[model samples]
Structure formats: C-alpha cells, structure tokens
Target: MPRQPLVRPGRKLGAVALDVSSSHRAWLDPTRETYLASGRTLGELGDRIPLAKSKLSELLRGVGLYPRWEVIHRLAAELDMPSWPLHRLWRQAALDAGKAPEWIDRSTRASAATARRRPPLDHDGLRQLVEHDYRFYAQVFLCDDERDIAVQDTFAALWLRWDTALCSPDIRAFAWSILRATVMARATYRDGRPELEAAVFDTVALQTQISPSAGAARMTRLVELFRAISRLPVTQLDTMVLLHLCGFTAERASGLLGVPLAAVRADERRAMRHLESAVTLKPDTEGPIT
Candidate 1:
C-alpha cells in the first residue's frame, strides 16, 4: 500500500499541494545544518528553536497551513541567520499556499494596542504640532488609548531633549526622527517588513465619496490602489500620508521628515509610478482612475 501524507486543518480550502510544501521545506534546509551541523532529528531541532515538537515538525515539513511570518523570523534568529531573505521566501510560500490577501493583511497588522509607558508633559510650542501628529498616529495605529500613549511618548521624549534638539540644524527634523523611530518600534511587521496596512482604509486619500455599488471596474481599480498604497516604501508611504492624509505641503513634509524637498517630490513620483503599475497590471482589466 502507498503512504498518505498528513492533512493539516484549515488548509482544505484551496490548500497547497504536498510538493509545494516540500519545496518550501527544502528551501529552509540550511536550518538543519545550522541546527546541529551534523543533521538534526525533528525533536532536537524543535528544542533548539524552542518550539513544540509537534508544531516544529509541522513547520519543518510544511504539513500545515503556513506558519505566520513571525514564526519563520524567530526560527531564523535561532539559527543565527539574517531574516530578510527568509522573509521573502515565507511570503512567497504563504501566497502560493493559497493564503488570501485579506487573510495575509489581517495577519500582518498588530494584534494588540501598543503600550507607551511615558507620562505626558505640557510643551507649549509643540502642543499644536503634537495634536496634529496625534491624529496621524491615531489613523495609523487605530487604537484609542494606546495610540495616545505613543504620541505622548514622542512629545515627552522631544521635550526632554528640547535643548539638544534646539541646538540641531533642524529641530523639527530631530523631533520627527524621534516620532518616526517610536512609531516604527510599535508598527506591525510581516515577513520582516514594517506594515502600514491601516492606510488602506483610514488614510485621508481614501475619503472620496464612492458608494459600495459604484461601477465594478472603478471599485476594482480602487482596490488595487489601496493595495499599492499599503506597500509603498517606508519613506514614500510617510510622504503620501503627510501630503494627502495630513494635508501637509511638500515643504512642510520635508521639514517634518527631514527629507530634502526635491527628494520628497521624487518619492511622490516614484510612489505614483508604482501605483500606476499596479492598477494597470493587466491593462485589459484596468479602469478609469476618476
């Protein structure tokens, strides 16, 4: 009699074939040597990666719905390998294994609100800017109390370093750096990439009045646009959010981000080009932008 493979639950819907799973496992084959360098039993590898034996076997064998990108990330760290390349493979495998875009999107967002521990302070000069920036963070993080904490921490850090920031060539830029770092630290990551998936819905650019039953083609193109916006380069993403969502001028965004005005414009062009490519991806299926 022939041997049958183990069936993973939740994968019965558009599940990936066993060979695809095996190939993905083979791609991570190096983890075996990194595990023991003399080859490793699944039990040994599981303990080394600090994963449950059953779960580890499922991942190593790709016998289940693909594990979350974070799991692969942790495994990479355990193996002392750079995670970026592995991240790409993990994403490809997930997509090829029939993970829906919606599923992937949900998996990529932060599961919980961020906790910012710093207490708030009153800074007269930065107060208005802080309020404005708070709205931006609120839109991005989409959590009430926790998003407030993130903004409060940014302002508090800036106030503490006010003197140092004042002495810098660009105080706003210095403050911007602090804000950027803090927000990124709290941002959700997938396959080693920080994600701003919230921009798909909450961003001001998405505020146009369009009904649910709007033309099917237009809506489809709109969906593609949202997808592109969510994946822009970090700098470009920030630029678009500032310009369209936050109503900031190019000069103002340049000041807040510490990027030169020319570069900011360049990123805008690049972002638009990327969007164009995505929306026109099939050409035949493309619809009017307006």
Candidate 2:
C-alpha cells in the first residue's frame, strides 16, 4: 500500500488553507528523516508503535490527529528521538486541529483566580476533614501490605497542603483531587509488582464491620457486595465509590477524576452492570428468604 503523506499537501478546511506551524514541522523533520533513513516504511513504523497506519501518517504530517501523551512517548522511543520535542509538536498539532477544549483554558484561569483569593484552612478543620474521610481513603488506596502506609502518607500530604486545597471554591472537590493523585502515585509506584497489588476485595471484605441494626444474613450479603465491587477496575471502582458511597454527583466525580462528565456517567453504568452480573451469578446463601 502507498503510504499517505503526513499532512494532506495543500489541503484546505472549508475555504481557508489549514495553518501549519513552521516550528513544529522543523522539530518533526529530524525524526521523520531518521525513520526514512532507517529504511522503515510507514506501515512498519505503525506496527512497531502499534498505532493504526492512518493515525501514524497523520501524526507524522503534523496534522489531523493529536495523540495522547503515551502515543507521543512511544513514537519518540521507537524513532530514537527526544520525547520533549515530540510532545511539543503533538501539542501544536492538537491546537492546529482545533481539538483543545475551551473549558481547559477557562478552568486554568478560574483556578488561578481562586488560588489568589482563598484563605488557609485551620488546623482543627484539617483534622476533622481527615478523620471524616479516612475510611474512604483507606478503601481507595487498599493495596495488600501498603494500605496503612498509603493512607498515612495521603493524610500527611493533605494535612501539609491543606492551605492549597482550601484555595479551591469547593473544598470537597479539592480533597478528592488530592486523594486521586495520592492513589495514582501509589499505584504507579507499584505498577509492575502484582504481588504488591494483591487482591484487595477479600481484605476490604474482612475489614468491613457490620452495623448492629442489620441482621447476620444482611451483613453477610453486604460484605459479599463489597467484595464484588473491589474486583472492578480501579477507575470503575473509584467512580462507583465516589458516586454511591461518597455521595458525589456525576459532575463532582468528573471534576475530581479530571474526566468529562459523559465519561463519569458511562463508567458508573458499566460498573453497575458488572456488579449486577456478579450478584446474579453468586449463590444466594446469605440473603434472607422472601
């Protein structure tokens, strides 16, 4: 198959010619030359990077698509090029493609303004916040032997940076953001070590204390439900917990996760379906007879 040119030469969007950045083109030139000099075809490059041929072509031309950070990083590694230049070029391409959202700019400005006007949180208030949210934080970061350490580190970080978090107009949203960052950092640090990430569902199930008002059967079933929830992907599990357990609205979850509202809704739906299927398949040994 004939390889497509990176940018459609002389292509116009509507009546106006697409504005291509000279700097981005210049930055991409060395990488492009190296790939060709290596005698690798576009298809070969795509196969190596595991990107679609069409997508790879668009990326090479500095037009059409703005790939995610991982994709840019992969291409840079494959081409033996510096990742910083590739990141710059990809960001430029995204801007030229008009793919950058308006809200991103507005949000940046709003956050700056909020930071300027917000006051510091008092020590007592910070302590209260940590005490109230510790259980939820434990559940969020519950990985094998690291659970207690992760929770302690997260709270310590929160306490240290409570003033910065207080700068947000919504304190809860700010707290959630901090928690999400802490959990992600801990997860990434342990990414390749599966033993470290040991199945948390069983541990979480054991730690859950039943309420006195609940019957024994009801408590057993509740534990079973939590175990099932713990089996979900981290993103889906976090979304479900934030929405149902933490009593966050979809909008709040979206803000905390730094994802679109639609994505939060979709994750919630998928999580619920997964939990429903698990519950349906399990023997009803613990539930009370109707």
Give the candidate number with the greatest lDDT. 1
TM-score of 2: 0.34
Worst 10 residues of 1 by lDDT: 110-119
Q: Would you list the clashing residue pairs of candidate 1?
A: none
lDDT of each: 0.57, 0.52
Instruction: List, residue by residue over 74-93, the lDDT tens digit for candidate 1.
Output: 66666554443344444444
lDDT of 2 by residue, 1-290 (tens): 22223433232213111454543443355455545544556676679878887677776666663445566556667765544434444444445456565632442343221122222346346546454444454454455444554444444444434544555565555566555544554453323321212222333322343233656665556555656766778778777666655556788667666577998899888888887778653344222111
Q: What lDDT is obtained when candidate 1 is compared to the true structure?
A: 0.57
- Model 2 residue 275 CA deviation (Å) reads 0.9
- The all-Cα superposition gives candidate 1 an RMSD in Å to the true structure of 15.9
Question: What are the runs in model 2 whose C-alpha is more than 4 Å off?
Answer: 1-136, 139-211, 281-290
Error of 2 at 211 (Å): 5.6
Q: List the residue pairs that clash in candidate 2.
A: 6-61
